[model samples]
Target: MFCYQCEQTDRTNGQPGCASAKGNCGKDATTADLQDLLVHALKGIGQYAALARGLGESDREADRFILFGLFTTLTNVNFDAARFTAFLREAATTRNRVKARCDELAQARGTTIQPLSDAAAWQPGASLPELLAQASTVGIQEGLKKLGEDVIGLRALVLYGLKGVAAYAHHARVLGYESEEVYAGVETTLDFLARHPTDVNALLSHALELGQLNLKVMELLDAANTGRFGIPQPTSVRMTPVAGKAILVSGHDLGDLHALLEATKGTGVQVYTHGEMLPAHGYPTLKAYEHLAGNYGGAWQEQHSDFAKFPGPILMTSNCIIEPLPLYRQRIFTTGPVGWPGVRHLADHDFTTLIQAAKALPGFRETASDESITVGFGHDAVLGVAGKVVDAVKAGKIRHFFLIGGCDGAAPGRNYYTEFAQQAPDDTVVMTLGCNKYRFNRHQFGDIEGIPRLLDLGQCNDSYSAIRIATALATAFGCGVNDLPLSLVISWFEQKAAAVLLTLLALGIRNIRLGPTLPAFLTPNALDILVKQFGIQPLGDARTDLAMALAPRAA
Candidate 1:
């Protein structure tokens, strides 16, 4: 039941992970075991799926199942052990379907199927205890004694990176975007894991390759979102509540938020974006709905207090859901890959139940004073004023750029990001995305000339925007991205940040600072490899890091 997949995982007694009855994220040992088993089952599906794809046979359903299944195992995404049990059974069924298809294709091609690993042939147990027993054999620690920490750590890196990729890919997939290459990449990586190769270099190489795959997935997602909702534009969103029946939409699914917005159009229910959904306000199509109020609360880590205080039904469209407090437990609903054992789940984007609950609950009885935040400074919006930005840089009006954001958590060390952003020199501009920006977004950074000093590039899902802006700026400057006067100060809480980090590394970006803590799964040897190869650094004092980033040598 040991798990250290997120930044918030307990390290009491110098333990490597949360091995107690309940993890720091509130996921119990049983749920953790079930998630591990589900991953093992997905590896089986991947083995068969990869084989099938190689044989000129493809199962789209099986491929999608792999993505969604892996996404569910991400930190704080799904904590329902029963849901994982069902997923295990479904994984076996999906694997069998792909296996049958592969066999048929091989027979038709007059080619014999190759022998497979235990994951490819394994079956799930009928009961929870039996499944837990099976899971024990496949846990991440299973090979530690023989393979050692370095190999296991690298494997964990690949696996966690894949989970992040799957989460992003799944979001794009829901909006009718599909990439066969991305699917193949995922299946191939999973198949690689199934074989349990111990070569450190090979594992590291595969992880970088996963990062490239994630870049592709992120591109597809960007297209899916922008194509559906139009490119995000600079828009001001209200931070204060308006009087009405309200439904607070959280997580990162724009499609779900759109559906709920459409459903409650004339029902007097105001849909407020929460957490990662805060960026939705910048999308033209989503914002077109007058009833789509504005963002509520802050990041995922504050949901307990935020949700309890919010006077409306809350819908979590994706990951970063916590154990719901009783105050709002009945009013909180889940969709997509997010789950809590007793929480009501809305499937197929049906918002009727959610809308009804919003009506029944007491929404904001009176309007709060008007306050707002600016968002939608995505690549399109920012690059639209490329001339001014480049001119400012050349004129020395803007001295540096800081990309400070990632998944935020309640860790006290997270205060470093807030201070880092706050302490940034007046001549420097800060561009942020993900929920982490909540720390300093409210602060008045003003702007360099006409360009805002703090640019909100939307959700972690909008990481592609950050990459795009960086590459574009690099192009304009006639230099490599790293050579540009920009620094990435990231605070990661979960797997999505892992994927984003891999993408940055794969792109040969270096000297990025990552905190609040290094991943527990990364042995010192593995950390050393990353530092030596990519110049990845553990974050230090915000002021010191900022000074270093601005030093003449850095440029």
Candidate 2:
């Protein structure tokens, strides 16, 4: 059909008539159409939020819709067709409200607008095959361009970051902690994004603004996490499978990690973190569980190979799910939006399936005993050593802080992240999360003042740690976040990475370098805007880039 969400596209590859085989990322015809509809609905809901704002409407429904819709669009989060259709129905309803409000705004302003007045336009009917056909006929390339890929891409980026935030927000909300301002940003930004036209300059401004909002979101989450679970501290998690049956938990879900830890309290099964889930070990509450074992695998992309080798059940809590190999397919259980048709899914955070599956799967034999790796360097933990850090800085013992973190992928060029982390000077500190951290987490980068140069800060979702550390450093230096001598060299693989990058941008943290390649989804115009307005740059060679990053800026 007609869909071009990834950087690789048939239209751009000299295959104008051929609708398939353009993107190397493995999404097919149906997946593409579903994604488009989801995006369209998200935009519609965003438009509605803007309308409600004009009327000074304070509706929680609008906020939830924006948050859920955006979260659903994130990569590897939601793959179930039935769930997507349900979301489409809800979004259509929200879209109508947005269009109606948009029309009202136009009328009040004495300007004519194309009123997306028909609520029924988005309503689904029995013509399922026909609709799919229609979508196929709809020029995918043309529609994406019309939608302003750059603007749409960037907005999607912001929404994705919020999704990561929402993941944390959801946990905090359940724990009786909520950030009203974050809720407001999630609503207002989505609404604004839905109706607003894509202007490079405007998006550049909004991108940074999004960062500012995300800073607040991260703060709210940090407070929630620390307040509920106690401040994070340095923790060393093992990397080997434990004796008896075990369940491997992946993604960024502390509550689930805690739940699993609680459920397995007396059970013989052990638990380990995989991918982004590795950071759960840093939390004081969760780490205290004796059954919580060490990390099993690397980032999400390696699942095809990594999951296959595991001797027990594996739980996928969120994104970065690759098609499971047949060997380990039965042992794989997914929760949250991560789903595959035949795999067991635990709805509503229910661990019945997880616990049962852990028991049923052939119990794992202890491969490594009591071995561990250090984790849990949130702002608090880092700050605990802030005096030493500052002293090191003053003594020229710690020269730089390289935040080498983001999503991991199978792309050949992806090795750059590992190379970059490896090449980082011994006097520097490497803060990382997400799968990208896997590149150099195991590498021996030497140490500065008893601290390893490469410090694992949990998962990609733990990018919050990087943000917190930056803000704290800035506070200590009595300057803004940008004024700190911190450099963020990020690698992006999916929408979540996109969102994290936007959060960085939203915070006005500029002069950052991103790679292996910019999202194919972004148009040149959008790229230009980011480069000129935000001073954002793409990555060069690791050594060269490191030199540029470490070089003192002009006064």
Top candidate by lDDT:
1
Candidate of highest TM-score: 1
lDDT tens digits, residue span 437-514, model 1: 999999999988888999999899999999999999999999999899999999988999999999999999999899
Candidate 1 least-lDDT 10 residues: 8-17
The C-alpha RMSD in Å for every predicted model, in order, reads 1.0, 4.2
lDDT of 2 by residue, 263-346 (tens): 788988888888888777788888788888788888777777778877777887756666677898877887765666577788
Number of residue pairs clashing in candidate 2, backbone atoms closer than 3 angstroms, sequence gap of 3 or more or interchain: 13
Please list the C-alpha lDDT of all candidates, in the order they appear.
0.91, 0.68
Model 1 C-alpha RMSD vs. true structure (Å) is 1.0
